[model samples]
Target: MTLRTKYLEPWIQARENLERRDWLSKDKEKEETQTLIDKVYNALGSISWSANIRGFSNTERTVTLATYCTDEWLSDIQENQMLDLLQRRLQHEPGGQQIKVESVYFYILLKRGYDARHFTCIWETRHALSSGLGPSCIGFLVNVNRNHWVAVIVNFNSRSILYGDSLNQEPPNDMLAILHWWMHHHTGHRFTTRSLEITYQKDAFSCGLLSFNALAHHFLPMEYPLIAVSNVRNGRLKILLDIIDQHLDQAGVRHLQGRTLLTSLFDRASSPSVKNISSPSLNPKPLLTLCDQKVLYLPKARLG
Candidate 1:
């Protein structure tokens, strides 16, 4: 049977209206909402969490995900922290121990005058390279001057860098050169750079998710599904849930489960438009394997 536009239009409209509006309580007073928020914050205990997650402060996590509870561009700090969390998740997955995820800060440090030699020092301090922990695959989420985000995967087995950009654009030449130089300097071999044909994001804010999914697909394909424009809202919710799940301890999880307010709040906030419609199946097109090799050269301009 042919699909009916009449039946599908509202669903499409609902996806477009992705922002959650009912964050505050609708009852006589907003006491319930405030209480729930406080509970979440208390469980998080930002000071201790920051010490554990390196630098991802409590305020950064709660403010970014709690305020809107909707699709939004991840901030630099959020993305980096999320990357660290994802790396933890990946390592636990079967066969994921072979993969290593580089911090977004690595790229940031390079941008701030660090060189290939500095990476050698960094790897030493992190105890990644010094301890004979040779990962077959390495993932990098590069932030291009706070303008755009991209994922670059260094596959040691293939001796290649797989580039993923949701905007269907090439990574800047200088950035590629830096990566190329880093690989050759550390491993003593030139690695080929190739682009991955990832699904193009239809909206602006989903770049972070897309870049993240690129790494997710490479390391833990079955666990973390690929997301594009169609299911990006659900994607956002899934990520939020994952973050909350990872940080919450058994006691905290039980505390959250004991209350209905938090669940109700998430339900109300996430399903703003479509109350009855189930989420669409997220089947994405197969990524094209054929892509031109990107030959890079070190730029004359020095790192700054």
Candidate 2:
């Protein structure tokens, strides 16, 4: 299906239909559906903002299901209680991680007394091998009312850090380029998809290479060092950074900073690494990256 028909139209319809529904009567069945519709509307609003940054201009881009639960019923009491639990947990946590949004969504639903679950999917090019390549796209599949719901949550886990040294394999060129563009525009760090190629002569490993988009300012201690290589040929880009790390300290910092080390291989025939290397060949120069970060400059009360 076209991206518009798949992602944008459905969400628009869902939101409109949701806004028109009456929920004050509290009929059990209608209320249940209303709750789900509310969640879907809110989730879509979140997804749209997220996708806008990734250069996905088409509103029809659909959100894939991640994981979901259908057995439990939702109630206000349960939802409020869960929200309290989540608020307390987040109090001790650091901000800016991708999963934080997901956690917030999960807690919001729970606090609102809805039974929900999470599911993830990856968007892959026709060339990607189905077996081992990680999901190109990932998001949660929520059980709203009695129906299933899908909403994209880009940047949900995009901040994972990858070490610069000890890379062994290559990743898909497009993936690296997009990611590089995203990190630089969204975050303050200026990193680049340096190169992607094959390595490990004996076993013949395909890897994706990336480095800092721009070297750190001389005065700064280099708070974040960019380094990542993924095995796109074999479809194990998700674990690329962890495998190449020489020290847990470096790797740990990257992981905590939410810098991504994973790569997506959308083609099976050409090693993902090969795709990365050849990207510059096909496209004269890298496209100007779009900034995905949304800065909320208002006070807390103003936000609501």
Candidate 3:
């Protein structure tokens, strides 16, 4: 097919359905976005952990299950769900990484809250913020208003920040200031600001999903901009929520005490020399490197 037929024609088709592209009339989009927000809040509240992923299945060992999430559980949770379809459409899904956003440690971390303090603990792996290359993407959720959320993405690899708010307002300076400090302090890099790929939100409640949108798609393997907006509009945000829920669901699957040494999993994948989670008396190797940023040597016993 010709380039116009392949590229230009599709944009025309998508543009015709601006609502699908989230280019809707202001009032109408607000109505639809609010409805989506309500559904998401309910979905998040009602999600259940599958027995298989929840450590109830002898067929699946708990410890290894901590490492691998079954698609069976994924399929169930995402059936007719927003996240299910996003996974189906995402051009680049994470693979080869032993740890995931849905690991037990991750949920525990989330349960407590996600803030700058846990940066090292929450995102210190190749699969995390890192592009599996030298570059990395950090998705920051900031509450600029007392109740409204704003999503900010810092791409260290590109030294750029992509900010999004459905309200179409600029992100607060105080939030950006803190994020700037955190990025420099945590990863030792600086990033500049850029307009988000799509800045419009359907309404107020969408900040949560909208921010997640920034983070979730940062790793998309598609071409520059890696835009997945059009496909997810029109109450299609369950995709983002399901990603978090799936991880939490997987986290719920770990056996009591079997949930130990979650950090060791990332350490193991990051550097072969690192120690295993202390279980069955794990004997860790000397710490050689913590990704491309730093290096150190710690006793195998101290890895946990």
Candidate 4:
């Protein structure tokens, strides 16, 4: 379905109609509708699945799936903060409509995706990276003119960015250029960039899921790069749902397969064993082998 045709056609008619009408709600509706039109027009290149997930209610955890992964589900700069708070608070409190608050959904999606034409959306992304614990690969999510989510990784240590789009269009030149300028101006950090060969994202709304998956895998890599290249390059919805489940666990997210997903990924990548590696991006593939048909031998490869 062409969102441009579906969304713009009616919107154009509405705008024309509104020019002559004098209704009280006309201005407000027009503002909201125009925002939607702009957002759709601005983000038309890939798949995005941020706001589409429905979740269980606190009062009705077993049945209804009405909650969103992010509260606002639009876009905002404060989204990461919101997500952090929700995870911390819910881990101890448990049971609340608390999950309904907005975070990464609006901050990253709506503002950066729709508003980049007017201002520097890349600033928030950069700040978010600098605020992290170390010089690391940061996921730079953005939208284009076709309404899809694209994933880029700003590798501070390598001084480069890896641009990956679900739709496989040309690299997001504007976004990368802005990011390059941001890094250079703020920290004198120069960067080279390359396009990454990626798997499928042909569906309409898979962009958000794909974007989230890219970041998640980096922070929670599998036993092998090949494994990720196979199992997760597609079937993103399941992984996305698992991530939401990881967040909803009020007992606090457990360390899985040795340590927490993010911890293990980062630690295993930086350990002394693999410390001599050129790029953390290409270090140890999770060593995987099969025994009898009984169990799977999946070992986390620490830095060599």
Error of 4 at 142 (Å): 1.5
lDDT by residue for model 4 (104-167), tens: 4433442454445433544565455567533344454565664566656666667777776767
TM-score, cand. 4 vs. native: 0.40
The window of 10 residues in a row where model 4 has the poorest summed lDDT is 287-296
Off by over 4 Å in 3: 1-135, 186-189, 221-304
Model 3: weakest 10-residue lDDT segment is: 66-75
lDDT of 3 by residue, 1-304 (tens): 6523332232222212322322233674666654554444333233221122221211221122211121112211222232232333342445412212221123234323335445545455423444444334444445444555555566665777778775778867755665576556556678788877553554434454444455445544252132234323442344434443554565653222221222322221332321233233432222211211121222233222
Q: Tens digit of lDDT per residue, candidate 1, span 22-102?
A: 242356434543454344433332212111222233334232344123445676656666687778887677877888777
Q: By TM-score, highest first, what's the ranking?
A: 1, 4, 3, 2
* RMSD in Å for all candidates: 17.3, 26.2, 22.5, 23.9
Each candidate structure's count of clashing pairs? 0, 47, 7, 29
Ten-residue stretch with the least lDDT total in model 2: 259-268
Report how far residue 184 has shifted in candidate 2, in Å. 46
Q: What is the lDDT of residue 29 in candidate 1?
A: 31
Tens digits of per-residue lDDT for model 2, 24-67: 22465455544454343333232221121121111211122100
TM-scores of all models?
0.63, 0.18, 0.38, 0.40
